[model samples]
Target: MHKEITIFNETILPGESKTIHMQIAKLHTMTDLQIPIIVERSKLDGPTVLFSAGLHGDEINGTEIVRQLIVQKINKPKRGTIICMPIINIFGFVNQTREFPDGRDLNRVFPGSKTGSLASRFAHYILQEIIPHVDYAIDFHAGGAQRFNAPQIRIVPNNQELKKLSDVFGAPFTLYSNHISGSFRTSCDHMGTKMLLFEGGKSLDMNQKVTDEAIEGSKRFLKHLKMLATKHQSMEAHATIYITKSDWIRANFSGMFHGLKAIGTFVKKGELLATISDPFGKIEHKVKAPHDGYLINVNDAPIVYQGDAIFHISKELE
Candidate 1:
């Protein structure tokens, strides 16, 4: 039997479910905002998993994935516990921006201080109040600045456990990534919680394909932990490409950009990937693949500036 769990001064027993509204800081108008933390516990004892999204408010695709899990009753684990935080940065979500009203990226500040900024305090609360009971976590994210990423799972290289979990989750692409300083993944690593970062689509947009991929991968992940309910069947996972090295292709000249290649397609060296032309139609520049590799990310922006990263191509694969 699992012991009772406490969050926000509320106790949840085995087989019990609850939604806790956590209040941090208020808006300038003295209006209070609540971040909902939804918890579901099974009667049997097992690992505790957390599914979180919306670290960046504008990354609504992540939010949609988590919300669908609840709507689909996937959050009710067969055993152990499942905690969902569909929107982590409510402040950013309200304004439909990536950063907080104070202009701080919530993902960059981790295990924060109690006396710090609003974002920092929320960070501190999560690390202190919520993460201690979490045995595993999957944080969803989307590409920023109009860059569309293929569905992928990211983990720091060299961890066999995480690698195995990634294989079980079975995203279309698994990329080896180093932990960023003060990131939630890094903080979770410090707290001894294994975590997987799911990246797909682009900010301020929703793609059914991306969300479906995420939802299916998440079910696979839960089933691997033996937490998925019997009614929900995990789909057969496709072969995943493991990327160890990648580099971004930048725009050579500022112009109206057009992409010819699709995301997630393999490109041969010197293959024409896109073209950039001035609005005046006087000159056009061709964007070609530098080497033979898969295109993992492509900029969806109509305009590009010189040195703007427009494509992310794999340099090495495992």
Candidate 2:
């Protein structure tokens, strides 16, 4: 049943849309920074779904996806609430950095404390304020700096409902990732919240393909949740595989890396995925696949240090 949702000490009634400005912390110059949340509730009873992005401030695909939702006004929740927090790390977002200004990853300090660092304090506040009111959540993510991730969903394994949503979201692949310490997924899981983490594109710049997929997949998900009053466009039916086990292909030598394939390409076992060569280009080292799987991520930067995870592969079932 749909219920009254509250965030940042403000109550949003049914069939209402409110932007709650949450002041998380004071800057070094004593200026206040706020996390703006957009809450849209429906006239009928349904599940409250939360869509968040920019936990790593540099990932702009999710931020752009939310912006488009607001621009198009497509998020008319017919029965439940839709909470949109596009940019969570305002400090890092403004600074064009992934972590907080204090150099701690915002995603690593979830279920945090009030007296902790800037990131932790913000995490604690948002986790306490917004997550409790949410019945389902989808946190958007992407590859770290100098890397790119194929569009995929990372879910906690053995959860059928979550698995069905992951499939309905229509990503080509799904990853069964473990919960990391202090992560947002971990915190939500502890609170018994069902959530999915979508990773696509790369850091900084927003790729059009990834962004389009995100928007389409999100609309499909909302439709599946019965939030939308009408049916969404029919996305092409494609087999979605689960990449249960994955590993990163580290650079064998300190040199320039030349990728053989981009995201979404399936490589065979022992296939040449990339080549690492010295600056002079006289000597080279090959980075090949140890198993047949789709390439999820590849280092974008040319120069890589030894043992850098430039390529990622996961074993999948067709």
> In model 1, how large is the Cα lDDT of residue 270?
98
Model 2 segments beyond 4 Å from truth?
Answer: 231-237, 316-318
- How many Å off is the CA of 196 in candidate 1? 0.4
TM-score of candidate 1 to 2 decimals: 0.99
lDDT of each: 0.94, 0.85
Error of 2 at 121 (Å): 1.3
Report the lDDT tens digits of candidate 1 across residue range 25-56.
88889999999999999999899999999999
Clashes of 2: 0
* Model 2: per-residue Cα lDDT over 190-256, one tens digit each: 9878998999988898988887887878888888888865634536535577888888988879988
What is the total number of backbone clashes in candidate 1? Answer: 0
